[model samples]
Target: MEIMLTPAAKAGLDEWESNGNKKVIQRIHDLVESVQRTPFKGIGKPEPLK
Candidate 1:
């Protein structure tokens, strides 16, 4: 599956690889973790009829 990411976000990921920026990696990982931990209860898209 292909995914699209913001330019800044992509750069953070790349920096983690090339420069091994541990802080940046940790910050990004924390952000993703918080998102996953939070419950998304707002309006969501329903499966389209096929």
Candidate 2:
């Protein structure tokens, strides 16, 4: 599965990085990788929308 960030999310990430939240940014990247590896299992609970 591919991960696509919304414009708002991209902007928020940019803002965070500019504010020196590298550790948080790294964690987010790690979470995204985890989700990509296992969409329905890992880190956080995966819930179906409908």
Candidate 3:
């Protein structure tokens, strides 16, 4: 699944983090990192030349 935040979600995340919600910030950061590790769309080893 593609993990992402919409503009509104991003705005809310920033606002909440600035409001001393470290736990929420940490969770979101963790989620972002996890998603980053996923392979990009169609990423794979090259096919053999027949």
Candidate 4:
């Protein structure tokens, strides 16, 4: 599967990497891949706001 990020998100990720926090970037990528593999199927629709 191909993962494409928005321009803004790409910038944010680039900034994050530049900050010397590759772990967070790696975590984000890992989570994205995991979700793509097994996405969350909600039980039902959201309730109406009060």
lDDT of 2 by residue, 1-50 (tens): 99999999999888988888778989888888999999888677778679
Q: Candidate 3 residues 16-50, lDDT tens each? A: 88899788788768666655675332223434458
Off by over 4 Å in 1: 1-12, 39-50
- Candidate 2 accuracy as lDDT: 0.87
Ranking by TM-score: 2, 4, 3, 1
Please provide TM-scores, in order, for all candidate models, with all chains considered together.
0.45, 0.77, 0.54, 0.60
Candidate number with greatest lDDT:
2
**lDDT for every model?**
0.62, 0.87, 0.69, 0.71
lDDT of 1 by residue, 1-50 (tens): 23458999788688786887778777767656554555342123324458
2 or 3, which is superior by TM-score? 2
Q: Under the 3 Å rule for N, CA and C atoms, how many clashes does model 4 have?
A: 0
Lowest-sum lDDT 10-residue window in model 2: 40-49
Off-target runs (Cα >4 Å) in candidate 3 are 1-5, 39-50
Clashing residue pairs in candidate 2 (N, C-alpha, C atoms within 3 angstroms): none
